[model samples]
Target: MARRRRPKRSNKEARRRAIYLLPNLFTTASLFSGFFAMIEAIDGNFLVASAAIFASLIFDGLDGRVARATNTTSRFGVEYDSLADLVAFGAAPAVMFYVWALRPLGRLGFLAAFLFAACGALRLARFNVQSDSAKPSKHFVGLPIPAAASMLAGTVMMWTQTSLVEPIPAWVAVAMVFVLSFLMVSNIPYLSFKSLGLARLRSFNGLVACLLLFVLVALQPYVMGFALLALYVVGGPLGARLLERGKAEKEQAEQLEHKPDHS
Candidate 1:
């Protein structure tokens, strides 16, 4: 008999076997959005730049969910997400704010922006190494990069709505940059969205409630964003303490439950 020939594996199958592409592609797009945001800021289009940062935030949020939903989570995906986040949430916002508002403050402005970028990188790196981290708590140990960037973006949007058309005051911009930068790497606890797990929701009402709130916010963005972001910033420490209290109560209950009856 003639020797049997083996069929060649198609490139698609080979790639599917070798790596997860969808989430990585999303991460790439997120990183690109950040870069484009910087370009827009450089061109003096602050509105478009802020919009791009928000665009990146959307993509950044999707990448992880896609990875988990598809059961394609991997170390590569995790690290890539972190790096993309640093660019999208850290470096881009800092640079955009620097050119748009902080640049007028001389060296102080430059240093403030630099500090924000550096702290973002540090925050990401620390997150990566904390292997035993409790399941995404109701809070974070510091200001999440995306939230800090969102606040900056929201502030710019608010400014655009005001009568003061001149560039933001140099001192205020400089001060804000430093404050936000410090928040990025600080030990202060901040809320994480994971406490409300979508998968475990018992009814559609939860989803409906969320959608309605989102609609309201979209209708009045400036005021809503300001209020929401302000609450988010302040809620972190409060949330953390609440979480700790909950944990302690559960532990105490468990201990009591384990005690033997004295008959």
Candidate 2:
């Protein structure tokens, strides 16, 4: 009687089959934090819930960086991260805003929250389907979902930190939510800070500016963080306009330079 030997799995195939745990672990933790935030908000623990959103942001950033650093990037990981972001940065903030302050606004509040969530979802979908040529742009095609969510979370947190007993007015909440929602799906170009090669900053002034910015943030995080986020939100549209004007002027000058010598 002869026994047959089975073919063994090759190392390359085995590696491919094995999911990389490190980056995905960060993503899972981010997803959990987002859920925890929603639960906290539901339970009327707004402060802690806001902190959880911040924690999710940290984990979200770490996961992508870890994937790149470890050379363990996978399509599976990218899709997983996107799902986590939708929960953490889109749904979580929307829920928190609704539970914490928007509830008092009644129908308007719920609608606003829904708008934010809907826009965030659309933003994520557009990102997933974006063209390769558009992918390398130094600016985002629209306000990033995470940034919009962060602005909401940061505003709530700043209010609490400032010891404000009065809840945000219905009008204010409605306005903020709608503005943020529109920004999410807008074609306005938002600066992609990732395009800045931080590691390659060799200029002394750049180093100084970084240090100063850090000091500014450390001094009054609640005020400064919210201010910075607000600045970014407003800056995007303004920046896009400025860039457009520059381009138009450049084209006009080029056309004049090539015009026939009619004078």
Candidate 3:
């Protein structure tokens, strides 16, 4: 009997499918981390749960970059990423916070957690719609859900690890949750840092700054991480306000300069 031959197209299809799975694998890892976070939170392993959420953040970041690099971007991947983000950044953080800090607040605690998750979902939906219709920009239309989650996670990690840090009051935790949830759904622009072009940087000062940042972070990961995330959360509104003020002052100067010689 003649030997049977497999078609070359089948091999190509298999290879393509494998490539596509690479990014989705990262997405799966992120989802698993988020699920693990919730389980750990329930088990009273708050530190581990916080760390798991951070791990999910890493995986979540990698998936999109991997997809882009591999030319495997698809609508399915986009939708999948968003869904995973809601689980990892939205539900996971909410559950972690509720268990670790918000539990004492009773109904108010759970409600704050719910608000965070709901705002995160709404933020993701808005991001998806904007991404499809709007021109690419360096800023996000609202606080990214992952960043919000990371802020909460960083707070937990800092509180758990540092002796100098005081325990957050119940009301303060509730307020923090409410603020983060509002920021997620707000229209304030947040720097996405996507166009920073760090890979293509040639400045020696930039390299030094990057090295210094790494050293600082390495020395006190929990404290430094929380500080950096807090700065980013505050920077959005501060930057916008500064820009608006500058524009207004420039317009005023122009108006004065153009005034007739009535004076």
Candidate 4:
């Protein structure tokens, strides 16, 4: 009997094998979640759309961690992740919110949603070019696109879950989308929680505070997400200004103290 020969992998097949599977699977799931959100929005299921956007966020977060942990990060993975983010965190949230609240506003509503998605795309592009490098910075250069999307998703979820007498005004939703869009592209320094090292807090009080915060979030998750996003979005610019003012004051004081007494 003749010996059976195994077929060899071609160059393209080799290249395909080089790409990471597990991380990309997560990214695909995120993209699917985003698509599902969009479909839900089209079907007039705002609540489910909001939830899908949140689910997309979870998948998006996992993809990077999985890639990093597995030592399988690659250029293909980075590009794929960004594309998934654009779909999941950019288009899905924008469309979901628009259908939820902005639909009644006509052209203004569509423009607002378009702007949010556009800004998110810009944010993702900037991140890929600048911050996506291996060097970790203390803070993000801009409000992350995911965070902006979360702001939308969390707000929708909050309104849907909570009992409120008056429905949220359409104008308010318009203004919020506009603000979030700009924030996504702004140069404000948003804290990167990934760099915070919360696990290694210096004091017992810090741990207790963290635990208390977790409990609060558990109690009122929708409120907590919305509240935290609001704080973070507003805090970025305020924090930047304060930091600059402090730096200028410190420099001025140092100059005064170092000056040879001119008296």
Best by TM-score: 2
TM-score of 1: 0.79
Clash number by candidate, in order: 1, 0, 0, 0
Model 4 per-residue lDDT tens digits across residues 75-125: 788889899999999999988888888989999999999999999999999
Candidate 3 — which residues are off by over 4 angstroms? 1-19, 164-166, 256-263
TM-score of 4: 0.89
TM-score of each: 0.79, 0.91, 0.89, 0.89
Better of 1 and 2 by TM-score: 2
lDDT of 2 at 49: 89
Candidate 3 has a TM-score of: 0.89
**RMSD each, Å:** 5.6, 3.4, 5.3, 5.0
Please identify model 2 stretches exceeding 4 Å from their true place.
1-18, 131-135
lDDT of each residue in 1-263, candidate 2, tens digit only: 89889899887666545578999999999999999999999998888888899999999999989988998876678789889999999999999999987888888889899999999999988987783236477888899988898898899888988877688877888899999999999999998878898988899999999999999999989889999999999999899999999999999999999999976
Model 2 Cα shift for residue 59 (angstroms): 0.8
lDDT of 3 by residue, 118-172 (tens): 9999999999999999999999988999999999999999998999466689988
Candidate with top lDDT is 3
